[model samples]
Target chain A: MTDEAFEQALINLTETMYRVCYAQLRQKADREDAVQEALKKAWEKRRLLRDESALKPWLVRILINECHNIQRKNRRVIPTEDVMPPPPPEDADGVMHDLILALPEKYRMPVLMIFMEGMNGTEVARALRIPPGTVHSRVHKARQILKSQWEEAQKE
Target chain B: MKQFPDDLSRAFGRADKEFVYQVQCTVKKLSEEKRKERTMNKKIPFGVVLFLAILLLAMGTAIALTIHNWKHIETAMDIAVENGAYWEWSLNAKIRLIEAMAEDGLAVSEGDMAALKGDDLTEDEKQELADRILTEQYGEEHFIYYYTIAVAEWGEPQTWTLEQRYWFFKTEREKGLYLDNSWIDLLPEETDLTRDEVVRIAREAVRSAYGMTDEEIESYAPNVSFFITDVCDTPRWMVEFYTQGEDGQIHGSPYSVLLTRDGEVTEDWENLGVLTPAQARLRQERQKETAVDVFTMRGQMRLQDQNTVFWNPEGGKHYHFLADCPMVNADKLPLKELPVWDAQFGLLTPCPCCVSLQDFWSLKDKLRYDVGSWKYPGPDWISEEEAVEKARAALEEEGCSPEGLYPAVYSTGALEEEDRYIVYFDALLTDPDGFTGVDPIYYAIVDACSGEVVSCGESESNG
Candidate 1:
């Protein structure tokens, strides 16, 4: 693909890349690191990308891998004091958002893509390297869990 | 308030405007590279090949004779010495090798890769950049990470974890330590404390935690491995205690305590690492209780309309820094979001298991906590007196008087595989009014361990 076309495609998905990255990494600096790393990786290996249509989901996969890389760093480096200091939940919406964050990674990722960013099963499967069937099943199980909890909050 | 899916999406979908702008800049910057790859796809025409073959055939005999004489090893060496033909070739070859490596993924940053792969940079500029990247910043992060790991793994370094950098340096490069003293630039394991003292500190920490005596601790058979925690970073000891809990009790397996060279426990990791069947079940039961605590806290906040925060309200317990944060429960609520002010965070403590939140503490905080000398550990070999004695002898041999000279030594030559005890002799003159001045007459470079006086001369200040 031409550089201009690649540039336009990536530009169009700026918000999407942001949403997916932010969902996995809460810290702004980490999110920025993940994005920059993913973009650089994508640019260097753009030739390996055989299909133009796969660019968006391809970028998502790169971003997800980078986020996991940042998270895996917890095991190796010495952590510092002070909280990550997530902005406090103002209302039920914020609380629900934290619930999604709280979900185990397998469920949290699909939930963010399918419900949050409106990505369909095919895109998620391609991005996550899972079959479409598995994507829907995980999303279904996650939704059931979220639904029961949301109902409890509504009653409260 | 919105309903289930909408409310959740509302929270997760929102990205701060600055984040969106940052992504824009990054993507735009990456997309502008003039990709110079895809050379293999170009097809060569038979006509061009035939013309080149005919041209070479016409001058083939003369070209072969010229090449055969010059390519000989002895002749090549002579040519290199006479003029500088071989020197230019050697330098150009190294620069080309660097470019090839960078193109193959040694270059961590986007600009390095772009400059090597594009037609934008002149030959001089490319050579200069490659030299700077190769020799400069040897002890900094991201410098040799990809190159070292790629050489070790022979696979893609980009896909590898950041931990691999330290792993390669600590274990894989141990054999190469003597072969090349290049590790000196990256190692500042300078501490006055002996290995025995550091081990004792670790042993005491384990003994106190398990409530065991030294003999009892010996039964567990604790093992220690020294490694760099961060690449181009400080050296740490990963002390692991082998065996499991007694009588099928659940305990931290291969229990580990990370300690600094200055003997400070980085965190309170009384429990961490893998889990056995019994340990998993016990952890589940413990989580059930935490879930209940969080559930009650959440309900109270909902009912009272309180602006709550989420933490282990307990002052001494660890707050998880990982994605699998311990506050989140499988069967129940996530965190019991509390309402503690930033000023009231006196009780919160750092996690011993995952000391991952580096940004939370500033560099000043790290320095204060780490407290390592970060000097070369050459003093461990020979004593200061030995170095001074060698220096005094060298001075005496040179017919120089040592009557008024007091010797001082340092280990600053390790950077060049020359870990020499550089001793300087000083003569001080004290005035009657209590003022004093000092003079240095001679200096000596004594081999740290071998006790050889490598070089001895007058002090630079004396001249």
Candidate 2:
């Protein structure tokens, strides 16, 4: 696809793509920065896309990569105390959001695509360049881990 | 008036909408900018391939420069060296011969295949084998996997007396631990902790769970393969201790250790792969990310909401990213709506013994929680998060808080799900009551997703 055509395709889905970026980055500013960087990268490598329809996944991949880059470079500072705090109440959705955000990169991308973005395991695999079965297993494992943690919180 | 959490959910939705809009605007600007940049790079297809070719050439040159490593071997190996040119030709010929013979459903004997080596196989015979290899072996995941096993040797210098053998094997099925130090560490069987430690942990866990005495534990421990290795670098000790469960099926509990050597443990104590709650919260990130990819070929076969356009491999276009390609919607579906055919996932055929993909995907809560879990293990590698946590705790116990620390989780849960979790932050360690508001933690879940605060607070002003 031509660079202009690719840009146009991405632009058409700009809103949705933005939502995905926002969901990932959390911070509006970071999301904007990530999406912007992703767009530029995608546009510059338009020919690499091969087909116009592949734009979404390609761009999503780029966007996620950009978020990683941003986090890596910024190096957020977390405070550490030796004391053990009381456990928080169970809030499935809230905890899910936090835990999803806490996941490692490999699981996060595939998990996001499968659950939040509402893509199937197959589509997630394609976008991540992983096999469908791996995606399925990862999702299953991710869910299992989440369930275990959730159960842990409830017990506490 | 009782208000529901849905109201907060709406606010979150608004935030999401605004965030999305903000990103779109930035994306538009960046795309325009990249358009200008692309004019310079000039859109080359297989550009990476070209770059890789150049890289390989450089590597080859480097190898060629190092002649001493090629110095020792047998005269037969020397003959192989003298016949380097011939062998190269022969290897190519063999590849062609194999490719051709793949067509037929016949496995030629070594003698016959060797006889055909100097170019004796008819084109038809070659084609048949090639077809057969492609159809039978190449089609199977294991074949492609096993085919990857290879031994490679750099080409010997022309002055060398013996051929320096370099074997390159590629296979689809991998046998060894898929950890980074795989080059240094041998298989699990070869590891130092493979037998004793693994057995100890496994036996301890089993004995505690089953209320077995030391004698019984010792007997079971030797029978089981209990040992731990630096397979994933996590403090993970693979507890392969097993015995006949209540169901009569031989079952094993492979516990992943999240605790430190100094920490006390009881069978009732929770194991989240960490010594403390803070460490667990911090280390869980690594556990999530280092998750191994056991089954190859990840892609969704179902569409979300059934619109299908958002995630169809047969859609307008397909990207190389596995997740971006075709996907089957596994959630929010009726049992009957599940796709009957999936090229990749279809391998998970239903068994009379258990649930099928259809059954699993269609069940209540979108998973067969009632059925037995897949007894397989998790990823073999440790997350950097866990490593960092271990490093930090070592620092803290040693009073190295000034070093400041970062935390990570192993895997991220799927998006859109309501997963609940609680991370413990100790007041004794750092009084939240004394601190300001939420602690500014530089945290992240997955490399793919950003991190958000679960909870951070100072205690209510020392009432």
Candidate 3:
């Protein structure tokens, strides 16, 4: 594709790519690194993109893969810590965001892809390379976990 | 948690202005990297290969045709040499001598030329046969083929074959079969000086005349022959040596030096004047244009002071205005200079300690400030109309008339390092004589912060 077209495509999906990276890699530096790495890979393999229509999904997949690679590398360096509980009521959205992050990795990925990245169940399935039914069940399980934690916090 | 707040978009929009700029820069870098990779991976096109093949075939055919048309005319027979021969003629010189003799009505044919062209006979033998043929037919004047030869062993008849030869004409402009006195060596009947003395004198003359070292003269193995000629009206020693020219071709020029009977060097022939003053100046200018800067492999930078700017050879990114900058290694004495404008164009910051101390402080400060302030536009910046207006004002300040002139303004975006927009203004100056063509007279880069022209220069082209 022409440089202008590739640039325009990146600009159009910048928000989606940013949200995916931010949701997976919480640190600002890590998020930026992931996005840059994904963009570089995409540029190197741009010739493999056959259809312009597939550009968004193709980019999202590369970004998600880059994020996972960074996470795997980070996991080896630091010991696993328990996921933090939801915060207080002054920041309700922040609380919900933390609770969603606290879910299992598989369910957390689908929830973030659906809510933050503005992707539907099938789109999330295509991006994650999983069955659409599996994505639906993961989103359901992720919400259940967040609800149980929210109710328990209310009692405390 | 009936509804997780859908403010994820707001959080996603937190990808700041800096992030966007960084992504753009990364994309630009990646694009350049890919372009380089593609260029490296590209193969020579088939059409270009085909064209080259056809061209070579055509050239080969032309050379073959020329060789086929070469006419064979005359030849001299091989001369026999005794067991102790000192000199012999080159094969090519023998052929040319025979051709010249045939042209002068000597009865030599293609068969004789063929017979002498064989490699079976020794060179001394060939020279004897050539001498006999010339003496019998055209007289001693026709014995024009002559060159100094070195025998491996004295007083021994070893088989010698001539591989390459040269044609010796009577004069540069004359084609007659004549060997000048300069080519022939007449052995001295009674010499006051020995061969070693004559050689020492010749070597000293060569060293003084040509500025060649003793080692270089020894490598040339100069051939010295003593002969008497009326040109100098005295006896002189002729010195000839093969020296490599600037073009990498070997050239041998004879230098004549007259010596008295006591071996005191008298007068030597002066060099023929070659390059005039104007030609020398032109050559110097050409060398300057093509010479590469030692600091940067690019063209030599010409400084504003008319001195070329050189950098430290010991390796530093900063270019120094002075060749002997303290930062430069003393052992690497001779630093290379580059064109000043090229250094500026390359965005190489000058060596602060070297350049700031000199009178070029203002120029250096201006370059550093202007280069640092220049920026590419981000997502939200100044409007194009504002950029154009600033550019127009900048051009007007540069003394361009707004009536006949038109300005082409380009917005290059905001500088990420500073809060300024980079706008380039190109003013098309209409010819005062009402000519059809538009000449770009002024190019200015203005900062959006203060609307001041950071850099301004005359444009080289209309666009």
Candidate 4:
């Protein structure tokens, strides 16, 4: 891709990247740093991206890896905030979204990629680097958990 | 659950606009930073324009005393190197260019060229020998003029390798996650066009296509190389101009064009880098013109299902055949068995990133990713220590001592973009008796997982 196209493509995905970074990282500063680092890597290694069709998942995969590196670095630090950036809302969709975010990261990312990010089983598998079947199983498990949570939210 | 996806998309879409803008800023900043870093020493630009003017200035010895003065061009190039117009390593690149130009003019055999590839002689000795060899073949006066033009052109390191030029096009055509790799090479028929005309056409194409100001051209150090592929009856001039990054790879989008002997650009020029208004209009014209990069909708990209080759569980715009999928097997990411043609596969819109080349022919072939895989195992690659140990053991196994050699460049699996840890070692050479420079002695590519040395090379210290 031309640097113009490459830059524009990355810009267009900023929202998705921000969401992915926010999903994985607790602090905004960490998210900012991770986002920049991932973009830098993607730019430096832009030639490596053989297929442009895979840019979204390919980039998300990079961001997730960056998040992993940050997590690895901050493994010992105690978290001051939970996964949900804000308190749960009253609406069913809002409540359900928070519940998804609250899911264990292994399960949470796949669910978000599939439902929120519109990534499919293979895409989630590629982005998360889990087996395709593994991605299915995790999404399956997360769905069951969300179904139960949705039912309970309806009751409330 | 029915409205869950829509709701989530809506909910997640509420992320801070500042966050999105900040990330955009980050991407822009990073691009600028990389471009700046690459051109850090390139403070003064205008190498090409100045040389072109100089060529015009040197009309003849009768009119201009400096017609014999190749010294001015040589002086200019020396000044460029000193001014950091070229990278430090470009000194090596400069000599390589001169040697290549000289070789082309001399028709040196393959055996001689292979011998010259080895770094057996000092820089000065190599320069002197190159001068002597070319001077003898093409008399002294002609040689000075020839060398002058070479020094001027050498400002932008000309890539002479046929493979390198073709690979530049091939790589651009095959963006890892973009289009299917279907390409047909249709060369414009050979002509009696002179080399000078080819270079001029290519330079103009690059300048116009990128909307590059003279300074931008100089800042980028647009390296243009022309090679007429004579393999077929239609031996056309392939002109490629690209900026070489620190990694010695194309840092910027390379623009190339195939010119008919008459100098008109074929459809080939339109698929490359940021296009100017004129080039964009050409894409508009390609509706009638049979251009190569027209990404026609073929089929849906699918994820693998049990028996169904690809049931379209997810939407992928591009498809790759499962054969030769070494990385996929290793990655455990099953290849989506795609249909020869299927409706289940979601709509294959013009994939945003697939803009370079939308070749659908190689859809049935395994997708090869060079850097990191789509899996992006860069951060999770084997640790540095493990990579070092692997390289160390391989070096010892090869009967090469690791003493005095330091691992200056250590890269793990995903960084290789392949599944190997690339460890390059360099030893500092002391010239108490003669000369000094760091010579890379030994290098190893170790498998990231198995710790096996995939390959290893050792260079005996020639000092």
Per-residue CA lDDT of model 4 for A1-156, tens digit only, reads: 667788888887877886787678766656776787677667765643324555787788778878876664332211112323444333325666567667899988887788778887867775775668899898889888887877777777
lDDT of 3 at A76: 14
* Per-residue error (Å), model 1, residue B32: 4.0
TM-score of 4: 0.34
lDDT of 4 by residue, B300-332 (tens): 222222123422235343333332222122343
- Quality of candidate 3 docking, DockQ: 0.06
**Residue runs of model 4 more than 4 Å from their true location after superposition:** A76-93, B1-6, B34-463
Q: Please give the lDDT score at residue B125 for candidate 2.
A: 65
TM-score each candidate: 0.33, 0.29, 0.30, 0.34
lDDT of 1 by residue, B1-463 (tens): 4466553556654566777787788766554424321112233355544653564345444443432211222222222233221112343443444554444445446687578557899875775565466545332212223233243333232222223323333322332321222221112133535555655777788788857688866655344544331112344554555433333222223235667656687662222222333443344333322232111222222223324334444432433333233223333334345443332222233232222222222222223333111125343557767778887898789887676555544544223455556666655434554212344566777777888887777764411
Could you give candidate 3's per-residue lDDT for residues B149-202 as a string of tens digits?
A: 111111011111111101111111122222132222233334456656776887
- Give the lowest summed-lDDT range of ten residues in model 4 chain B: B290-299
Off by over 4 Å in 1: A50-52, A75-85, A88-92, B1-3, B6-8, B33-463
lDDT of 3 at B270: 28
Better of 3 and 4 by lDDT: 4
Candidate 2 lDDT by residue in tens digits, A1-156: 554565568767665465456455654556665666666555544533335554666566667677766554332232233323223224325555555556766776666676656667655764675667789888778767766765666666
TM-score of 3: 0.30
Residue B363, candidate 4: alpha-carbon lDDT: 17
